[model samples]
Target: MQFLVKSARPETLKTATLVVAIGEGRKLGAAARALDAASEGTLSALLKRGDLAGKPGQTLLLQGLAGVKAERILLVGCGKERELSERSYRKVAAAALAVLKTLGGSDAALTLGELMVKGRDAYAKARLLVEVLADGGYVFDRFKGDKAEAPALTRITLLAEDTDLLACERGAAHAQAIASGMAFARDLGNLPPNLCHPSFLADEAKALAKGNKALKVEVLDEKKLKELGMGAFLAVAQGSEQPPRLIVLDYKGGKKDDAPFVLVGKGITFDTGGISLKPGLGMDEMKYDMCGAASVLGTFRALVELGLPINVVGLLACAENMPSGGATRPGDIVTTMSGQTVEILNTDAEGRLVLCDTLTYAERYKPQAVIDIATLTGACIVALGSHTSGLMGNHDGLIRQVLKAGETAADRAWQLPLFDEYQEQLDSPFADIANIGGPKAGTITAACFLSRFAKKFHWAHLDIAGTAWVSGGKDKGATGRPVPLLTQYLLDRCQ
Candidate 1:
């Protein structure tokens, strides 16, 4: 959708829809009061008649109000004037856009950006408004034979004051980039496993680099992986006919001497739990197993779009896990690239296996910091549910940075303990470690297993299993999460 910023009177703006906020107890926001005055107490009369309660997410649509220039007016509820917050503001914007989508309007002028959200400036408000509206309009009907009709709302204009116009414009641009990145991630995650395999991801990396002078792409096939002694990664891919790939994307936008931030992703395109197969129920959602890989690519798309001056490297540990004759079985031991042996007590625990080898490889870059994203364990879902990503790391500073980034982006994470005590969960008498750390604290143990390989540099892990995608219902698809968090982190770094 096209986004524009204008510093104009709400009633004077000629658009298909004019969106304004109404707080509880019949409080009218700045734009709402102006529009109400122009319409001769139309809003007040409706409120007095109890037409709307102004509760959060409540929306009321009116057409051809007396003195308004717009064809329609959309009143979005903002629970309380003093209680309006970042989260509530997003909900209000989303509710407004959701109504706009069903209307006949092709364009809308939103004054919801003018709502006072504590600690949020005009730029932040505008950015969030665009993000929410764009996200609300997203549809994944690519595979549907009978595609649904597209929504009429195609353009959104953020009404801002003269002093805030420039900042709002910048925010709109940033949000557009982020929305593009999210759409890319969502599309990759939504693709069927049959089409979005390890090789397909490598091709996507190459495609993303095409015509982008500052970016370089490289892919390592099975032979190269074997030569590099990535036994742990290979063991996971051995069962699948689709060969494994180690895809590396380098973006050189900063000084050559500066150390880059490395991001490693577990690109298990389709995980069937290998020899320790998962139950058939809800197995279709395994296609989202590679959301970490998708998020990496998505972040790159946003970075390149913004042309941020920073050196960053993305590592995609792409592989598929299936239960085949060649699949690594229980009680098998494989030596990782770090020369640490891992016992495969449960083939289902494969994400860490791929990430361990990739993290070991990241040491070659001498990175300033490394953060790996993965759908590593189901235990993360049990602990954090679908709301937050589980975070763990060896360095407190890096962990705090990630945690703060998630907060800034509103894609929050809860830090799980990575104390030395948890390392015992992965202890194996036969090998340096065990892939499965029993059942308790599965998320922390998985991070503990990776922590051993990342000791050379400051490292953190995002276990996105819980927040990567929805499991069922009408909203069952990729959320394209933590891309906002990751992008925000990098954006903060550039400053």
Candidate 2:
């Protein structure tokens, strides 16, 4: 849907609908007050007629323009506006979306609810409303057909005549940047794995890096992979004819003296589990294995568009794990870039192997922080379910910051413990480390394995296994949860 900021008055506002928010039981302030003058307190009288009490998310449809100039006035409940927050905007925006969908409204202009803004002023409220509109309008429907029907809202025009539209330009720009990055992720999730292979993902990085001064993209082929001793990641890719690729994207927006923040993502285009093949049922869903990569790409897009003053780099390790004659089997030993050997006890534990070398490669930059995301283990799915991403990091302050940002962004995170006790499970009889941590702590072990590669730095690992993709009767494909979480975290750090 389209959205704009306008200065037109409510009476003169010409649109399919004009929505005004009422704080808790209080009637509308401006629009409703103007509307009440025409009715001679009839709206308040009508409330007595039905003995109706307005609360959060409540909506009352009133007709006619007595003293009011607008044809229709929508009284939306804003709860106790004084206690409202950015999160509250979601509820208010949701009510607006519901109104638009019901009225088949083509365009809407929402006044910034004064009650919702404390000392922050009207511009913040306008921006919050914009965020709410964008969020409420989001629908993951790549697989949906024409027969399916959803809310067809075309535009959301924000109105606060006195407020400077871009009062804090950074946040407003960042929001659009975030939206663009999310769009890229949605595109990747929509495509089938057949078209989004290891090479394809690598090519995407190269395309982003091509002519842009903002980033330098590099694609490392099989020769480079073997040269760098990425045998752990290569073991999973050797099974497929398509070679593995390591993608590096560099964006230097900060001062030269500033240390870069490193981001790593697992880019498995498809996973048939090599020799340890998965069941045929729901196997096609494996296409979303590259969702981690898609997120990295999304983050980069946002960083570039917002022009944030932070030097950041993103590493995507792309591979397609399949079953073939040459595929690495159970009990195979593979060497990593860190000169550590891994005993591949479970082929399904392939994501850790890919991340190990990718994290080790991060050391070259001496980054201030390193974070890796992957659809690593089903154990994480069991632990956190689909509502939240599992966060395991080395730094306490960073974890808290990320958690706070997650809450504000409405992309929740629950921190999982990373202890040394789980490290023993990775002890290999014939290798330096075992890729499979064991049966009990699958997620922890996988994280522990990746942790080994990011030594001497504040490292965080997000296992998005549970939230990466969903398959049910109506919904299927990547959910793109932590992209916003990670973006918010990055923005916080950038500050």
For every model shown, the clashing-pair count is 0, 1
* Deviating ranges (above 4 Å) for candidate 1: none
TM-score of 2: 0.89
TM-score of every candidate relative to the true structure: 0.98, 0.89
For model 2, residues 99-212, the per-residue Cα lDDT tens digits are 777776677767754455443455445545555566455576565575337565587677654455565333345556676677677678668887888788877777776777
Residue 294, candidate 1: Cα error in Å is 0.6
Cα lDDT tens digits, model 1, 1-495, are 999999999998999999888888778888888888998998788878877788999988888678889998888889876857788888898788878988988899999877888777888888888989887778899999999898888899999999999999989998899988899999999999999999999999999999999999999999999999999999999999999999999999999999999999889999999999999999999999999999999999999999999999999999999998898999999999989899999999999999999999999999999999999889999999999999999889998999999987889999999888988888899998988778889999989999999999999999999999988999899998879999999988999
Poorest 10 consecutive residues of model 1 by lDDT? 80-89
**In candidate 1, residue 160 scores what lDDT?**
92
Best by lDDT, which number?
1
